[model samples]
Target: MTNHTPPIIGLAGGIGSGKSTITKCFNNLGVQSVDADDVARLVVQPNSDCLNKIYQRYGEDILMNDGSLDRRSLRTIIFNRPEERTWLEALTHPAIKEEITSQLSKLTSKYALLVHPLLFETHQNAICQLVVAIDVPKEIQIQRVISRDNTDQESVEKIISTQLSNSERIHRANLILENTGNIDEMNAKVFKLHQNILELISC
Candidate 1:
């Protein structure tokens, strides 16, 4: 758990709180990032063992004609049913964790960013040396999600309901980055945070 080993920085934020923006900013500063969403998708690709487990649990209907897991269909199922979501998480989380750990082990940067929307829910924050939550109002989250995802307000709210609230994340995180301001303000916060993180790791 020494900082000399390239600390894992968990970027935890709500559905539309701009975690991706922070991740991109870190990337611009030459920091390595591993996104849990990307790892989740990768583990379920056409021929993966995780996909086999999913098919075994949900049956052939969850698969496409091309033998790939129909992610949209599965997402609909799990999000609507807590039992199903739990079952799916149990099957996939372990694999995702393994892959993320492996990827982090290979990072050469001063720190590696683990971008996860469900960082706290999945308990992925346990692996991070520091956790930073991006903050925004619930209204802003809903509006931004609707605009960015082309989804309805109700749908965005439903997704938000499933995640830990902004306040909870802010309380739990080591630092908080408020995103209510403009992009320039957000960039400044990211830059300052980057310097602060570098100093922390160096110490």
Candidate 2:
């Protein structure tokens, strides 16, 4: 089937940079949004093949008593080991991408706001007509992650290490939504950028 319109707006940013907030704002505007995080969660849901593979590969250490994936423990295991991280990524990303592609195939909107922490890193940015990065200073990023994830500096730093830097993210994005401002100000910025995006595809 031919799509009437394809996904166009991609939101990529560090863990605590408010990409989800911006995506929600767009959703309120009637745009369908696809979340890579949600997609990732589906990939590892209980009793899923991916979960079985992970259990077999990583052993039973990552499972909870309730038969669900212990995401935190799994994260700790992969955080310090590059080979294990790569192995897990290899196992999950393809399935995640397949599911996302199926979802996108059915999307009928001027654009879909695709929220991904590592959208660019996966070579998926090539499909997005425009990318918006909700930018924050590094100091703020570190603090936000530590606060939001309730993790210490060392773990937060390791997570950040896996992601691209602020300058690098800005360099790769077509637009930057700097969120250092107040809520009202940030809302205004998001609205303006939304308008600009509408104009871009309209032209």
Candidate 3:
């Protein structure tokens, strides 16, 4: 890699919209990636400071019998109540941001992808040189989530309702990838974008 700073590309999409699928495409092309969701999960591991704070606030019921967080219960709480979501974000977003920054700094790839569902929501998009929004129809998103996660439609809809609308995400992004359920097509699109990113960065 050149001494020039590697460009950070933020990948944004709704739940089940296949952000990870495209991130994996970039990974296959030799780019490194940092996922905010993965970072969030890491920060809340059992015995971690974040977990301790959460337990303090919400009490032992928020934990599983194994002592890990009861993520499903917490998800239900936050999605149903806006104030709870705000409180949770205030507690976790900063730590997630710090971890993401540190992870990005250590990447040696020509370009890096930061995959975040809340890229625009949490203002994390500001750290990215560009953002790619994966565009999938709402029905497709709901279907995919139900099929892949075995989740109910109501829960999926509730999650989707919390996120930026398709138009809003597109408005905030530099590029858009329409995911129509064809893996090969998506791969081709990502590969082209990868090459384009490399060329642009090399300049």
Candidate 4:
């Protein structure tokens, strides 16, 4: 039988909540970290099997002039039509999950951290013993998205609507990492939490 020692920590949050930064702190401490967003970006690169399948399903209009996946076009299609979104997820999510699971299994660290935006929403709790949700205020998330992505308030609301609410995620997680502070504060909180996670994982 295959050994089933799983990841020790799962870091989750909605977009613009500094989940990447939190994962980086763990990286500095020599923890193995895998980010789903980064994986998603890689999985959708030009000429990738996922991108080719999407092109076949959705047509060439979804490609930019440079022949890369036109994320805006795909996003518009997915957001405007839930059916389309489900189709894309059906095609891609399994591949993402399988790749992540494989990478996690290959890690040599004493513990691993899965940094996922939708850990709770996708019910990936099986991978990690301690699920830490980064708690950022809804308004802050909206403002960050608006400023960082140059998107409008309506789009921000729509993206937020797609995610599980902060309270719901908090209730689902084993721990919560509040992240509505400056970089120094964020680093401190992450460091403290990493220690706690190490202790917990050692149990």
The lDDT values for all models are 0.88, 0.84, 0.89, 0.83
Between prediction 2 and prediction 4, the one with superior lDDT is 2
lDDT of 2 by residue, 1-203 (tens): 24564756888988878777777777776788889999999999998989999989877788998888999998998997889999999999999888877777778767778788998888778778899887898888889888888889888888888988888989999998898877678778878988899899787
Evaluated at residue 79, the lDDT of candidate 4 is: 84
Assess candidate 4 and give its TM-score to the true structure: 0.93
lDDT of 3 by residue, 1-203 (tens): 23443688899999989988888888998999999989999999999888999899899889999999999989988998899989998999989998988888888888889999989999989877888898889999999899998889999999999899988999989888899958899889999888777776677
Count of clashes in candidate 3: 0
Using lDDT, rank the candidates from best to worst: 3, 1, 2, 4
Measured against the true structure, the TM-scores of the candidates, in listed sequence, are 0.91, 0.94, 0.94, 0.93
Pitting candidate 3 against candidate 4, the one with the higher lDDT is 3
Report the Cα RMSD per candidate.
2.1, 1.4, 2.1, 1.8
Task: List clash counts for every candidate, in order.
Answer: 0, 0, 0, 0
User: Which residue pairs clash in candidate 1?
Assistant: none
Name the better of 1 and 2 by lDDT: 1
lDDT of 1 by residue, 127-155 (tens): 88899898899999999889997878877
- State in Å the error of residue 173, model 2: 1.2
